[model samples]
Target: MKKPDLISELNTAINQNIIIEKNIKEIIDMSFKIFKKLFDEFGLELEKLCDFKYSSYYSKHKNIDLDLAIVKYFPKKDVKYKEFLEKILDTLKNLPYGYKIRKEQNDGYIAISQETSSKIINYRFIFLVRKKTKTGYCDYYNRNGIWQEDYALELTKSFSLANKISNGTLYKVKSLLNYVLKDQFKYNYGCDAILITWFYEFFSRSLNKYLDNKYNKKEKELDFVNFTKIKNLKKWFKYNIDINNLYYFIFTKIGETNTYYYPELSFEPLELFEGITRYSVNTNTFFKLPLSYFSHIKVFDLRNYQDVRLIQEMGGEEYGYSKKAWSKARDEDKRYFVSPFIISGPFNYAMFKKWYVLTSNSLFKTLPVEIKKDLNSLRQRESMEFLNMTGHNWISSYYAKLKYLQPYFDKKYPLIKERDLKVLIRMITTMVDKTKQSDWLLENDN
Candidate 1:
């Protein structure tokens, strides 16, 4: 039997403004229906355990392909929540239709995808628990915000402990502390320290009052320049910082399950550091540290003489920090640590709209020559035909074509409005229809 023409079907779907198998509302409703059924099957009260929030799509267009629905489940003491969740996941996984379950720890979501011919719909759920404390109920979900002060104090205490462990070597302790906290506090790694500091400063200045002035002062004075000289920073960080004490503190306080890596020290290198020093925890054996153990430290920039010296001492010359190397590592880190596994349907549609704009602009000779050339290369008919012929789904086929064109579109027209793209698509579609008619007339007359 001959296969259905996927491109023709896709084009027809686009022309009718029906690119997705189901719209956002329908998809979300379907998800809830399925969840309700699952809950009923397990003799569970869905409403009692679960709450949901619908996040707006990226595009404001009514027919936007993607929507996000966050489902939060609060565990009760009487309920076997973990087993129930596992059962749900197992049922979903064993379904005949295509379903992907991704548990992302960082984002705190269990994303389940239901894929159709045209799109992959996502339902993201977060399981939250509240513990009874002396003051009140502590919501574990928002602990990062509530517990920032506690974390800062803990970190400060850890630093002091490290100083004592290093035989009162304050400089070494300060250098290593800076190295660990720099990524969390100053750098952009979505850590809690920056947020806590920002909130304190912003509110203090806005209200014309200092809230926790001591913390503000301490954070301000904790700059890298104040702790150690640029040259000696590397020496102290490498040789003098008590690795044993560092490991113990991190393992006990952060690395263990309870603290959730303590948002402040939650960078990937810390995970690597923990793994490297895992055996040393609660053991008398001293394992010789491998040179490669510090390899993940390259993600940090060579800040001053200290950073440069540290990198050099770690054989930076041999493992050159070229742009390509840095980019590769950064990309890997994003994939492993940052980027969400779930694809945003609305974002994908937005990308398609951008491509349409670029194509229309190129055809009408409005785009730059370089962009036109790139666009033409990406839209080569033979390549697209080949991809469609290979049984690739519409999402895969669209992205395969887009993989090359997207960079150019992003670089050139980063802020192309949705309304403008829609207008252009309509105009381009009308123009193409006229062009086809004219060609048909000419061919008939000939």
Candidate 2:
């Protein structure tokens, strides 16, 4: 698994058209031409108001379908930046390609779309403002003549809870507090602050009750506790918990599950307050869009593709939800977790085999034998769990049934092979590793 050998194999795979590398390159070339034309027309006008640059060059290299650019504008003494934004939107609308634009109040981006060869491609140009306190910048919202960043930062500094509290339990506490305090605060003092205050009180009372139940016969000296009575609680909370980690969890969860597609625009509306934030694990930064800006943009249905439609006929949609099914689930419950399946199981298995070949050349070689054994054990356990959940025995009977079903299976139960299960585990674990090291917002002027 030398680097050179891996590169050669990858090149061979591309030459054979084993993946969608050719299609990706064609789209990237098309997107670049559109981006360059826009920059040529209004780059100078944009520069006069703020720092403007392209932000999705790295994304083009990945197997995604969208492109993005960003403009960072600092609030000036008396200049009207909103007017400039409107001018940009007007220019986009006037393009010969018939680009459609979508804008939102207090939002950080303008979404644009165009159709080419019967397929729609989406582009986003995010607007960012410089932060007042530091050299860094973030998306801000205007509230009562004041600009405020994400409330997560403020809430992180206000809560004092035991380090032993699990993240799952803390999330439930936050949800409960938010619901109870919504009517009382109503954005006057910020919902997060109100939630944190009451959450601290609730946690203290719960802990006291648990302690009393455990030591019913024993006489123990205890002092009455409250959030206000605790000295240096904010400092303790800051020292104990990493805010970045908490924000990362919240951001990733929202980006994955909390989205709705606008029927008119054919894309999801971007809003920072509505949990549309993207967190880059590598840089520890949060932005207003997902790593793949067009991931949730559904201009065409998955069934429209011939290959995907055939797979869906074979119970692809039943094995896991499609993008449309996922959106429908969100409509039913915004908090529902839906994992979308667009590619077929066999195709995924092939890709996973290729990925395992590439990584085994380097990463697997570096791990200790014991760790490798543990990973194999984990792969086995997960495979069994998946089989049990999917109700697939993966034996002779399963294969016989699959043959009888032909290209279509009963929608009630989907099935897969037992041997492909290991590859699936490898694929998921590798993706998680890559996400942790992803530079989703890499800027490239060239």
Candidate 3:
């Protein structure tokens, strides 16, 4: 598309309400008003409210259709948090654009929607919540003056924990997180201040850029005027952190025109997280929550919306793990990979690990001696550098389930599609047959 045409199309969308553009500063100001209301109503400490800054924004088309204006909140305790939630709901229920409650149990929502000739749509005002989990989420990364990297297996465990928390949240927990963050980040001094302040500023800035990229007709064009590429290590991570690409799928499958362009205030407890990041493939520059800047902060897909169906239908509570994506064992062989679903078509970190193991074991056998020696000499990172979409001759592994990459595979290894598929299937089959991956495969495989 021509540059002029693209701009004209974007302009037309805005004029027709097909697309809505805002000077991002306006978004920041409007979102703060919502936070201010929460702070005043809860009587939260003024200092903490000051700490809360505009972090990011996201819009989803699902049970709730709203723009989630994310703010960074730090709280000290759950002090009367439950009461604050009750009051907020009661107050909003009386307002003109307030959400109408859909489900009031542990999992439910209150939404504000527009009525059209065909039906009511453009739902917003979703407040999702969750019971405090015992997952490895470190409330304070340096609470006891211990750094995460110094401990054994601590880093990986933290990544795993982050993966768990970012999953979609149910209702009833949104108000608690929103109202309680003031206490979450208030600091005394020294390391506590360093960590907390670091957490607040990085996310406030990172998410700001990440949220602004929604305007691209194809990929989100980097708003260069607003975002700068990360070059300094002071705020950068010590190690490469993995980020989940699930939103790519959600947007492809569910995101539609008009439903999300206009900002309708929403309260989803889940995606508002401050630590998440989205690394750009087009540019090494990053845009996302800065949590990944911490070497130990690995991103995992938290498909929370997947759980709502089970929660609403049964409400009985006994259905348990039976409701998770991994609950169906039979579907693993055919339907597990999630990367192919993203607009970027990225693969999971696990798939890269699998390819490494398989190549070392058999795929590289008798490779001309020079090639074999040279390949073997490469480190894990070196090996992976040659495997990404931008990398040379990368194969479409069975794990990615990317039928779209079949042409690439066919061109590289003509007439071997069946063999490649079989080998890939065998790799996963052996994994399932030999290891205790039933749960891991269920939760993160997709």
* Best candidate, TM-score: 2
lDDT of 2: 0.32
TM-score of every candidate relative to the true structure: 0.26, 0.28, 0.24
lDDT (CA) per prediction: 0.30, 0.32, 0.25
Compose the digit string of candidate 2's lDDT tens values, residues 337-380: 22222211111111122223343244335545654465447454
Candidate 1, residue 268: how far the Cα is off, in Å: 8.0
Model 2: colliding residue pairs: none
Give each model's clash number: 0, 0, 18
- The parts of candidate 2 lying over 4 Å away from their true place are 1-18, 21-24, 39-67, 73-81, 105-108, 131-446
Instruction: Tell me the lDDT of candidate 3.
Output: 0.25
Better of 1 and 2 by TM-score: 2
Give the better candidate number (1 or 3) by TM-score: 1
Which of the two, 1 or 3, has more lDDT?
1
